[model samples]
Target: MPDAPLTDLQMKQAAERFGTPLYAYSAAELDAALSRVQAAFGDARIWYAMKANPNLTLLRRMQSAGVGFECVSLGELARAVKVEADGDHLLVNGPAKSDEEYRLGGDLGATFIVDRLGEVALLPPASRVLVRVNPGLSVSTHDHLATGAAHSKFGVRPDQLPDVLAALRSGGHTLRGLHLHVGSAIRDAGDFAAAFARVAELHTLTGPLEVLDVGGGWGLGADLHGIAARAKEAAASFGAVLWVEPGRYLVAQAGVLLTRVMGHKQTGRDFTLLDAGMTELLRPMLYGAAHPVQALWEGEATTSDLAGPACESGDLLGHDVTLPAGAVRGDLLALLEAGAYGAAMSSTYLTRPRPAEVLWDGTQWVTMRRRETAEDIWAAEV
Candidate 1:
């Protein structure tokens, strides 16, 4: 992953000024990342997977850049609408379709990546839709992140493609395209090549296609150059426009999670306790993901376990984390590659209020989301 864009001093300043367990992103970094992908893909249409980060400030920035959004739920579409991203520029995608979601999908005229045959009926007649085909292939990634496997609950099985196509045609829905999203955080180019190749083969069975949404999950360390080439090839092979929904890759390295070492302990194993926990960022506990970590002050390298204040023992963020020898109480540690799923997936589990989120616009830190108070957490509770 790229180095944390925030400087050590800047991270420390944010921690001191805003408090620990904060998420700070760089607007400049986000722009640069978007520009890089746009330049690399050249003409392939790009859409921001709003599931990664739905902060209105970031969404407005994406909208200003002329990028579309791919929403997985009604709430995500609502968030995009709040940023003035509506019409054809938005896409509604997910496995299960709710009545309200289908209603909104048609009301907004947003493209739909239909995962099931039943969804075709749920959509408004003649509404634009793309069938998400399960390629019966799996990318070499974490199981929870894989979506294109034959048994995955994400898409329509390839064997059922013809039936789905016929269903779309008979139902009067506009079959705008086909989509295949194998998995998330794919590090190997071969995986993408295989998935795209399968989609291309399936294209032969379908009628004239206008869009090919090779769904996104490109990781921070994947081969973008090769992926870009494959995207071009897929677009050419299908004689249609290509759209990509890159989520983590575009924003993961642009933000950092700042947490302070509250204390140290040596129960069973050496542990450095921090104010942050699975509630602040769940990827560690959920997916066993490891983000690069470093302390503001440098010292001799010492391996230690890093954990959060959550009651669950599985709330550990990193096992055998190496940090500065003198890293002790009150030292700020910046967890890198947290821009994507960090605050976006945070929750009020254990009634722990969510942390604050800010963006650095080069001049200074601007608060995008304030820390949640107990009332903010309980307001919706009956």
Candidate 2:
């Protein structure tokens, strides 16, 4: 199967049928990505981090594949519950979980990943928990994506693990294991190696544990087998089962953002504007993420920055994008590697209706979510 789900023809068809600023996914790609992870990990428990792409259809797809969920918020937990996820298949994770999150997660019997020492006292009685460990290692990704750094607010310091463990014991909560996620879109194998080594040093403190969740930050083209080997070795030190929480790695390549070339302008930089922008996909602005752009029409190639309709001057989707010079208004463009965090982070900024989402199931298209209406946007407002 192709790495991307929709073909050029299919993307045009989707744009024509559904309208621009649409999100399209491929069912086969999602399954294939999952299979790749399962093959590399070999018996490791896989938890789909729904924060990457939490569409209900995708959640159901993950559920059918026997993949559990790693949720960080109440909405994600609710999504898991909607899919009939059992307690054994749920992991509640966040740095600052709220009371309602703890209550619902506890009611579901989900394994909560405790982000700090103070959170130990807040968990439900006898809650199963994993202590998130910050390895304090610099990684080779965007600074904003680096969560395992020493100053990051994500995990407890290694020195504090003992205190966290003691608190868990005092609170009568079950300590399932340790969790370590360095960062996202990481390209270096050495980063994972170093993190695994750092976490392994804590074996003397943790003893033999139930699980060692070396959280997933595998870049799109990362070496999974190599990373899994390191993870397995780390877990072996503690005699713990390996569990992975993969969000972007499983879904990033399977989806595309279909937007139309609405108009063009030149302001120091050649700008090809689209109907979508920071509100539709924030990674470009938030983290300087670069998604490949494919133009449907043909002509002499020209380099241009892809801009969105958002009023903010920073609402650019891509920079120095190469497209056919003949590409005109109404022509479609597919932003590749957008399957993860694209739609999940979209908003109604500027009152732009959040785009519709569709899935190509090999032979036909299925509407996963309808386009939002102006009324739908204000329905919840007073």
Which one is best on lDDT?
Answer: 2
Q: Which pairs of residues clash in candidate 2, taking residues 3 or more apart in a chain or in different chains? A: none
CA error at residue 186 for candidate 2, angstroms: 0.5
TM-score of each: 0.98, 0.98
Write the residue-wise lDDT of candidate 2 on 1-382 in tens digits.
Answer: 1234678888888888999799999988898899999999999999999999999999999889899999999999999889899999999999889999999999999999999888888999999989999999999999999999987989988898888999999889999999999999997989999999999999999899999999998998888999999999999999999999999999999999998989999989999989889989999999999887778778887899999998899999989988889667888888899999999999998888999999999999999999999999999999
Residue 323 deviation, candidate 2, in Å?
Answer: 1.3
**Residue 159 deviation, candidate 1, in Å?**
1.3
Off by over 4 Å in 2: 1-3
Model 2: how far is 225 from its true place, Å?
A: 0.6
Give per-residue lDDT, candidate 1, residue 26. Answer: 88
Q: Rate the local accuracy (lDDT) of all candidates.
A: 0.86, 0.92
Please give the distance, in angstroms, between residue 306's alpha carbon in candidate 1 and its true position after superposition.
Answer: 0.6
Q: All predictions: root-mean-square deviation over Cα?
A: 1.3, 1.4
True-vs-predicted CA distance for residue 24, candidate 2, Å: 0.5
